[model samples]
Target chain A: MSRSFSTSERRVLGALHYLGFGLFLAACTAGFVRTWVLFGNPPSIDPLASHRQYIQLLDRKQDYESAVDRIEIAQQLAPYTAAVDGLSIQGYGQIGLGLLERGHPSTARLYLQRLFLALEQTTELPSDDAEMLDMLARILDRSYELGTGAEAILKDSLLLSLLNNLAWIRATHRSDSIRNAEQALRFASRAADMTKREDPSLLDTLAAAYAEAGRWQEARQTERLAVAQAERAGVADVAISSMKQRLSLYEDRLPYRE
Target chain B: MSQADASHFSVTRLTGRSFIHPLFDYLVIGGGISLIATIVIWQSGRSDIVPMAVVPLILLLSNSAHFAASTVRLYTKRGSFEALPFLTMAFPCVCLLLIALCLAWPLRLGMNLQSLYLTWSPYHYAAQAYGLAVMYAYRSGCLLTTSDKRLLFWCAMIPFLRMFFCIQDTVLGADIGLAWIAPSSLYRLFEPYQAGLDRMLLIAACAAPLVLLIKTWRSSSGAIPMISLLMLVTNTVWFFALEPINAFVWATVFHGLQYLAIVVIFHVRDRLSEPTNRHGKLYHALWFYGWCVLLAYALFFCLPQAYQMLGFGVDESVWVVIAAINVHHFIVDGYIWRLKKGDSNRQVVDSSAPAAAPRVSSPAGL
Candidate 1:
């Protein structure tokens, strides 16, 4: 039953086997020494740095799919790193925004959804930062307008700025398909109430909502109150001027549009 | 020949000089070079070099080329189709699609799927190592008794068991979805015993090979093949030396290379064995390799993009497909390479017999 190898073949096989073993031992030893000298500790991997490098590479290449893939690995490696989480949020946001700009609204929705989910996971963001809230509000507003299924997201947001922005969009959007005066009034009222009627921006949104609903007298009164409060609170002159102009429009029985 | 005679002949025989040089076949496809390569990449301190370049290449080749290549083989050949019934094959495909669809929800099913894949991978790698050990043993003229096979199987499995226990509180602990697969209570209960168990398993794995060597020496007149022993050592190094993540990368690359080399060799040999084929040896070899590469690329890269275009998320679709392919490979390889089987194994392993004709048609050019 035995089928014998030629003597030469046996010699070759034996040599290759020893050669492989030698190479394996040599490479492993060299790798350990090199790694110890360069890295100090073999097990102490800084996944944060690795994550950043992968992100930068993906960013430069504009490979969004790979970026998303690498980010998941990064998240697993350093699940609690603030910087890593921030990068995940930013990466998803960039991809989502890029997709939106490219007219891939449906695909963009997926990325943006992931972006928002990542943002929700981050503990570093100050929940009370009005400007940040306003920026998120604007982004979500645009996402909703693009038919990206962001309406539910906008509705679910409890942030005062986001609610006010939604109201404002409903009141003054250029497209009739998007404008909804009734919804605007409800959102504006809710946002203004959340601020205890103290935020000038929420008051402004309420005024626009009233105007959009053709309630000229209420719109005029609300705009005047917003302008007076802005001046008393030492708000920027540009904002005060805008409020006054809106007041004039309401007084003339015209709804504000942007 | 009778089955016993055929088994003895096949076990004792070296592959012919005409088909593949015995040294190359034994050293490379039989897992020698891959072992060295795995060690080099796994232990190397050049972090900038390995992860940046080597890791990605390993991932692509291992999963896309190697893992998905198995599925490509299943559908490409009529014999494979016969080996795996259509319904059996389609079951996993349908399940994977459902899983992909479930990813759209908030159930953390993707994480669960990843955990399952990760958990199953070590065992899969160990099984392949055990299988290859027996294969090299049979090829190198060692007629291992049933007890010897059992010993080798346990020895190979020890490293994987050590890995499984050690991983309970790490990645597998948090992400594994199925409670039945890795129950939370068991992880908690085993928490104190993990270190001790790992140490015990390591000791057992190290000692089992020595015991095997002695037993084989006594039973088979010192005919124990170095390749079989080396296979066990390779598996041990793969599990013990590297961290889980690095072990995964190293094992995957090495295993993939080993699998790819063997599958391609098997394909070439199977085609060359055919009596009706008029093509030259080079044409048969190239034709088989060319289609494998093309099919691997299409399945791994192009299909994911097409899924995205069809409205699935790129991340979700790609991971789902990859996971599905891996699960399918694990299932298919369980039976596909059994030497006792009469079809593909005979064509690939029994080089002493008359060559069969090339039954499948060549692609347009070759």
Candidate 2:
């Protein structure tokens, strides 16, 4: 029951099929060459910018591995240039944060360590931009708090915020394996000394560190002092209340765990 | 019409008996059960296992193989080149290339191009569904009157209208690239109407098939093929039943498979009829499908890797190629399936002339 087609009709259909195949081959070839020629090489004057652009594209696509690889290339290409260092730090930080959010703490720690190493290599950063260094230090400290790594090579000059974060982490880390009462006490005392015990948040960290070390009387006294200072400084009432609750915990000889 | 006459209007009538069996038709064309099965499997918690396993393969076939098949009908034939004109073909390719270059250059216009593509995609899906529905209807011998055709077209269009007015903001608005092009004024204008429009379109889309069914019943001799009704229903499910991302994934896969099935059937039937000497070796259906799979792999997977190795941005290049192919497919499909009086029309549908008899053999003959 097959319908007969004229020879011309068969020829036309066959030609159409071949034409389609040919177009596909042509398009694929053209696209491959066009993309390669256009995006393959780094820009002559701005290789760093080109690498940054490629890294951004990879980040958007969530290809963390390729983004990391691009970061490495950019780092090698420019070494200590502020722009390349900034791009690498941002790229690695993004991948690290993304992995952390996806519950891959160990993998996230590796990226965060890479970010810190990149930050350290940029020694020529303007001395006036202390805030940028402080922000990066805080980020690195937070990453350390999240998972194990990079604890051995501490920054030479730690910002007050980094000290407070590290002190808090050691004082109240939920895992017994991570908590270090002695290190928490050291960081808390140094941070408090630098702030002259004026920052209520620093005093709060000191209280937590005292509690972590089983110094209940000192912990209770520090918590009370923190609450009074916070109230005088017009900290949120909720904060003052939370400080009081911590004082009560110290009064009962119980350590704060967060 | 008698049962014998009704049988003449089936999918088996158009595709040779060797190619189409009832089970195959039901699975591919009567796609309601397929949608239901996918939904059930997806929701079963173990859905991840299957989708994770099958989705990549489906993507290759759907995005590359199915998309590439349209080229056959558009550019291969001598008439197609003349009909399309060289300038018309070059324009889109050049435009897409420009868009890709803009994106690579990190320009704002690339964002606009992306927004436009996303906005246009649902309509493309709807148009394909409508075309397929009409095709099935014609094959099944449903003598659709003018009003019936209009109704069927609107039915196909309703989902896209809903998508455009209501769900578009949620899907595309959050995208930074899309937001660059989407004016705040348009959002303000459409925001209030979105809810009402969505509900109305949902109701209309749901009810249109029933209306079609009733019209088929009232037309005395005309019968509504189950496949036609299923197609409309499946389109509704694709738009409404799943979340936007999931809907995009599942619908694309199903739609791709559907297109592939039909195109393969068309290719096989036409090739078998052609003189073997001119065509070289005659391909078995399986062998033809294998070739399609190889082409898909080369295009979707291998090409991107090659670009990546050459230092082109892999993800961007892959996305650009995919977007380019899609834009080309939509444009090509616009005219390829037009029911004109010629061998093309006769090959797909039975001739309405009284002098012509149904030459298609029954399924048992194969």
Candidate 3:
């Protein structure tokens, strides 16, 4: 079935392939350097998609390891992407709580520390799901409404996260509709107690909740303690400065709102 | 469908069994260029020698070109517009609607669509490799027994299997590696199992093809064609040897070359088989490729720019459109290349002319 070909036809065909290859290669090269190099190729937008999708899904699935892996990648790919960093903040908080529940406090602290630094940097919660904060608020409100006790409604880690995250949101969110000082105090006190106040970040959240409730005396005292705890624990200088700034605000009888 | 129309095509081709020339097919379409370039890059140990723009350039030339080639061929093949009504008439609308949905719901639909494309990419590459290998074998008058066919199929699949393992374990371990949609728990729990399995998969990726070759050699007493073997090895090396980031760039380009080569061959063949085609192979090849380039530019560049004009971010406009284009190509290829009786693709398999004597041997139930 092999068809015979003239020698010249074979040469022509082979030459044609070379020509095609050369032309395409030349076109791409010229197009790339002249146009794309001047303008830039489409920025790889992997993290833009990864921000909302991977971290939230993995965290919800309680796949902490994979969530951490994705968080690391997203962070590496787009360092300042608020959505990704915010998702990482939430992811790390959940992962730390999960690890602690599994009796890995040392590992838990590692993730919690990352969450702490990330939270201190961001002025607002940029977690991919904008409704997530509302969801946390809803969960907390429902738990309180259940009358059976918030502790009974959520697992230990979930309860702690709901308390910490919602308290932070209520105490510092710019929207007055979401802020409720008394509720913030209630959530923060429970979180402080749950962490035994040893965690400086939780203490700071409790202090912010205190400032929101207009209890300037307790706010100053709590913030002073938070600042001390933060410094004693060798927290980052930027965070210590932030805590100190909040301390000053309470000293001036001002409530912090981000 | 009629005698006069059927008579236009000469028996398979008027040349030796290899599509175009054996040298042309083997070197350009057979993964030879990719293999050589990869070896050179690795041996040089200086990946940076190539500018970063080369990535996009390669994508434009090879990746984008080959993808457009399928669509161009589908539309240009005489009677295809009549044969594939949905594909020609309505399927583009389907693709357009899908793109709009993805654009409107970037998170819900767009991410899923993007992930689908990412996950399907490697599988598509492997499938094309397997396809081209088999087509080359058919064209070259190589007879593959049933067992031989099965062996070749699995051997070709080693690349996918290797990728599957590297991702963590299962397919959907189909990693969170090349695949965008893998569960974390499977990827993590299997972490301990991964190292051992990777070694096994690596061994298998390398060894399985050799076994297939030896077995086929013993059974059929015919050596597997060099092009087929090259395809098997190139796919394996593409996933394993090249750095993952670089692999994405080079593999697509090389695979693009392979696709463009065969698609050009088929396209020219189809054109020439038309009794009315007054042009020679070179003219037809250039015309087809030129259209592919134009379409590629329009699809990849201008469409994205148009989306940007409509207030989409450059990211979604470019990537989502790219993803949609790929899914369209993949789906179209799945249909256009089916080799059934009375199918245009039957000519691709049949070595003789349309009514030229019976095929010396069809690939089992090809």
Candidate 4:
């Protein structure tokens, strides 16, 4: 077919093809240029620049719905195409967490169901796909026990993650007041490791778990480390504020110990 | 011989050539008459299923008889001076009978003129499966003749389509009712979750047949076969991972697209030559049947006229029946024209210059 075209015709068609190819390349180049000029390497990959401020406002007013909505929208568009699926799972998880915070357990269950489904479809086998699958499995396992029907959502990976989270929580969080605080720490720590040691929430959860277990020295150390890591990674504000609050609480109890 | 005598001899040869070429003419004319006669007898006998019951019996017996005759002829013609001629004659008859059997039995199985072969009979469904098998056998024979990778690819996907459709129909719970693709007992398996999956699969499946056309595109060599290979790979992936509903839709669309691709191939060849005074009678006839089936589907749906003209109520599910018929017609016609084109291409290549040659290459035409 290529041979059938005359030399002149070949030249014309080839030119047309190359011209279209050039235009496509130019569009892609222009898109990257605009993105760089506008953002110039943000402190964090927070798609919604105002999300932290909104969360702070929500925390002060205790407006869970507004906080949830901001986080949901931000999470949805956070990742580039390479990381979009992971971000989607994270977005669903955040939605569920917001629902739980608002005391809407039934609604939270529904959001968890979508998360479970998305996680089920995704594979975390390191060779084939991104390692998002393991993190999702851990989240779902916790959700399964917390939600109404345990057996209905008891997926194989979820069960595996449940055992791992429980073991970690038992070893670290031995305190009685926050019995499940150790479990939350274990879940978040394992999730962070599974996500290539990237997520800041894992650090936050571990610090909380240690504090609940009355391991004050370990809790303070973990919180300080978490704040430093978040700042270095450009996710500074939230973890830094939380760390300052924890330090003040520790200071208040220090005089009695001395 | 003298010049006058030589001219007369040449005239006779030319006439003989025309007569032999008119075999298709006789086939078409004879088939039409036989169909009319069958309908007349069918109407006169007119008991439900009984009138149509004889069609299968007659076809089976006649085919069996033809097979026996061909076998006997093959035996009698063995190792004799005149054996070659008899053997040649018997061979074609046997082949023709096999083709006739393939077309007739499936066409007859649970066929109704008003409904256009959409009765929910197991026999008809099985017959479609049988037809797909015949297509596989036909394609295997085809692989020997032309180097078209795309045709070979379409050949490969045919079985996957059969399997997927079989599962789909079962899941969908096909009954005599005119349910096209509603949430029935069959679809309940995945009803709780998403939509649009089936349509995406359908598009992929439909595009699957392009492997053949794209492969056979008039060109040099090896690269074209890749198209067929890619189609086969993608189709295999779709068949395995996708659920039966999506899988079946994909298979159906692939089947439809295969036919449409062949039509495109014909148009491409027709335009390439742009032969003066082109005889499109056969092409037109084929198109007529294709369009007629579509027209029948449309007419069946237009209720007031349908009730007045045919007095049979229409259901939306009748569209499924129409679709099934369309699938059958597409595959059947695709096979016939492909065979014809292959034969003609071979003849043109051998007797004329390469420029005037058809693209197909079958031994019969050669």
Candidate 5:
């Protein structure tokens, strides 16, 4: 049996049939574009998520070049998703930190400044939106030697903790840096008191601050507690390594090694 | 079973479709609002403008539109009985807009210290009021329902003034001689009954686990799933900001996970409620456990980097953790509970009306 359409039905059917044909052609074109876009890409890769994870992992390993590549890839993905803004900022900060660790101060400064700018752009989001604050603190902490300007701006508890750790770094290096370093240490110690006891990293910063300020006995006690707390948080290896580095610097400074 | 009883059971199963539709609708609406708000905020170019301003405006506009469309749909389907729920939802929508307008007027007119502080006060009230109104809408009750007037109004209206207290503490810490905002001030404002402002939010966030537990114990097959989703939303609000209770986010996550587990049980039993098959229960339990464990691990590991990107301080790790945990709970619990059972119970228990037809569309799948 043959079915005949009413006037309205014929009109609707004609519109839908044409639309479907157009969509089929568009889909074919889209498939071609997608094929070209992923010509040599790995089948299992999510470029954004994978790049972000890789940068974080590489930064942990202090591999600056690979981390930078991943960071660029993450940044490329940012235009597609708002959530990637935070990932890009973190990647840049990590790369900058890695570059700084390798003694490339100028390159590190550029990366850190870029990270800072990215964070600054996003800070007005919400009170609870902490992405900017975290990136800014990390940058300020890692590149504290960049200048006094950063020290004045990053007065928040997290950055202050970073500055306090930087003070310990400065205290052992140059005689001219100790006064500002002492001030930073004091600020960090106050910050530590407001935080929970489980945060071993903050305790380390507090201890480092005290040590740089010539409060030797208090520093030793704090360092011991910090080591224990760090172990509990599953970041014991990093803490232990930083502590060992601190011990060597202390031995160089004071004739008596606790 | 009698033919009538069997027909009722089939109807119960059919209720799932209604529940699923509203949930998908809510998601689409909320997502649309968030996207539009993001664009507006990005374009506003206010040095002091906050993202907090965006979502509410989006909600206010989107809800009003959705309500209008729904009013027409309801009127077409079931006449007259729809008006009560319609007016209740409509009145609140108007009030929210009016409140936002009044609050924005001062800032628009001129900027002053008083205006800045005053502007923030409206947001706090808005959050509480919106919450109350939405609860009523969900419950299919009038504004003067027992939950609002008897329970929520008095409890939320106390205005613990935690923000002021925190500001005072910051000033005092900067200068030891500053006496206006001290720990003693907190004692005077909230001592024995309340946990102080900071801890009060923490207390609220912590309540999610208990609420879930009690709801499950009393009626796991009841409103257990919906309440759990609401808890997740509330936790996200509390933990994301620089609120007093933000520090306790990890603990909040634990409670959320437990709630997620119970919600799973409710859904699985709802799907296959035959009086036999003990092993089915074990399978359901294992599936829930596996999901919770996977989510917990992923959130714990990836959250720090998320915080870093959001321009948050490392201390803000708690917020990311809370957000991830709640979203995970929403997805997992929503899949199990909302998909299994339909609106047969919600439509009856909530208000005997279909005003809550829209709730099924919420992104969080409440």
Candidate 6:
């Protein structure tokens, strides 16, 4: 059934094959060079870079699953890096909260559990930013309640932030049942020690815990320290002014209310 | 003209190599379904669950071997050098260079290549399904007209078309290189019509084959061969019946098995047909498959470890390397397995059981 090829046709086919082969090689090489010139290092397989670029857009879409996946990939590609942790904290916090809002707390916990399979990877967990305070607090609270083992993987700064937020929430909550002055003081002290009492906000939280415990003298002293520390640390004017107002409230033996 | 007699006649007329041994061909190569099981799976509810760990294991075994089979066949097949000189000689170097470049700059070019592979994968599977369907028909002496072939082609293409509707949704789903890439603005621009389009595609994917069966049955005045129907329905089910991830898992395992079986058969037959060869069928079969398995291990496992030693992450090397291999397999496969260009793959089109003759014209030109 083999058909004999004419000399002319065979020549045409051989030329076509060679032409195709040359075009393919040239195209791939050109593509590689163009990509290098345009992107320097295309984030194609660089999870960390991709995560950074798409984090905002992912959040906007409430695509928490994708966000968590990207975060985990970034984490795998560059473990223990400050940038990876930054992404994880922002991403996991948002994902955990979004999952909760979507009534997927169990799924959220599963994601957290998977992200940090071993506790040893937690040596340099991401620290907190002021902007991430609320997000981390809510996520940590859910973690504790769900017993998701998220705490076991926490870095020192994030753990400190978690303790500070819990103490602040308990000490200043308007609902009496939610307030636990004794537990709040313990948490506040732990958070302050973790930061070596350097963080002005931790000091402010300590003042709240003291006032909630009804120790006005220590509360006033702590509030004054918080104001002085905030000013010394070159904290924002609004934050320093707030610390001063809290100082006055402590003088009146009144606990802060959130 | 009697109903029972006509049915018996149809069954008696359908005879071939089974495209291999009957049981293996039906159960594994036809994809997770036996001769009867294909029919049952077609009626069963789509599966929701996905196998996470089994996928990598299957890919390690089947994907690497099946992919390499085409290349091995191309190089060793008689007259391939003269027929496709550029592909046999220069192409290997090209593939090697491309892989090296991908490994070097994985983030940009490597990542895009991986996406290209992922995107091309289903289309490759669909094309293979169409191919095997025709091969089996020709082997079993079914004289299909161009119209019948057209209907079957569309039926087989349903899966690819469905994937085309949502390539980003179906294939990557944020799995590539860790990016939650935004669908293009054009994708969003079509959002208003997306839901309706999706519904239509899914419905068409599910219904096209049944329509083909009925149309072919009526037009040809006989049942389209059972194995051909099985292939179409099985392929569609692999892509459409199960959830996307689960479909991916099943498709990989069965498609790999199917490819491995057919390629092994061809390799063994070619070696046996050699006048100077002393090897028996079993010897050649085991030899080819054993080497395929070993080579797969070298390509997927050891090579990646070697790359890792040369300072690439295990995941990065494995992911990109496998993607690059898939791209190579898809391209070379088209060349080697082509039924035209003086390569009829007599091993397949002439694959009928010994002593059987065509019911109509010769299938050599199929």
Q: DockQ of candidates 1 onward, in order?
A: 0.02, 0.06, 0.02, 0.01, 0.03, 0.05
RMSD of each: 17.0, 12.9, 14.5, 24.9, 20.1, 12.6
Question: What lDDT tens digits, residue by residue, belong to model 4 across residues A78-150?
Answer: 2110111222555555556555555545545555676667655754322212233333444455455565422
Docking quality (DockQ) of candidate 2: 0.06
Query: RMSD to the native, candidate 2?
Result: 12.9
Report i-RMS for every model: 16.4, 13.1, 13.1, 27.7, 19.0, 11.4
lDDT of 5 at A163: 43
Give the C-alpha lDDT of model 1.
Answer: 0.60
Question: lDDT at B351 for candidate 1?
Answer: 57
Per-candidate TM equals: 0.55, 0.60, 0.56, 0.25, 0.27, 0.61
TM-score of chain B of 5: 0.30
lDDT of 2 by residue, B21-74 (tens): 656765675465558656785577343535444555556665556766666445
Higher-DockQ candidate among 1 and 4? 1
Per lDDT, the best of the predicted structures is 3
TM-score of chain A of 2: 0.47
lDDT of 5 by residue, B1-366 (tens): 687445323433222222224443223311222223334434573312435345323322222122222222222222122223323223223322332332333223112222232223323332333342233234332212333222332233222233333333321112111123345665556435433555765555446435543443243122222332333334334332322222122212222232333234333554345456455766865554454343233333333333333343221232223222333232222222221124322322243333333332221223
Clashing pairs in 1: A35-B45, B273-B355, B273-B356, B274-B356, B274-B357, B274-B358, B275-B356, B275-B357
Predicted candidate 2 versus true structure: per-residue lDDT over A83-159, tens digit per residue:
22334455666666555555545545666666666655664432233334343444455555764433433453434
lDDT of 1 by residue, A73-189 (tens): 433432332222334455666656655655656545666676667665664443334434444555555665775634444334434655776688778877676677987897799
Instruction: Give one digit per residue, the lDDT tens place, for model 4 in B1-366.
Output: 687445333422222221113342122211222233334434565323334335323322222122122222222222221323322222223322332332233223212221222222222222322233223222222221254433553444443433433333433323222222334565565444323444544455555546543543323321222222333433444344444444333333332233233333333344334456354545643443344333332222221121212222112112222333333332233222323333432232233221232344221111
lDDT (tens digit, per residue) of candidate 6 on A200-257:
9999999999999999999999888888888888999999888888888988888888
Q: Candidate 4: where is the Cα deviation over 4 Å?
A: A1-258, B1-171, B175-224, B254-258, B271-274, B277-309, B316-324, B327-331, B340-366
Is candidate 3 or 6 superior in TM-score? 6
Instruction: State model 2's lDDT.
Output: 0.60
Off by over 4 Å in 1: A1-258, B1-19, B38-43, B46-48, B51-58, B87-96, B105-107, B168-180, B352-366
Off by over 4 Å in 5: A1-53, A56-258, B1-150, B153-248, B268-272, B275-280, B291-366
lDDT of 6 by residue, B22-124 (tens): 6676666556452233344445654322353354555656766787677667766888867776576556557656866877876676677866776677778
Residue-level lDDT of model 1, residues B224-292, one tens digit each, is: 566667667777877787666567667777777667776776766666667886877678656665665
Evaluated with DockQ, which candidate comes out highest? 2
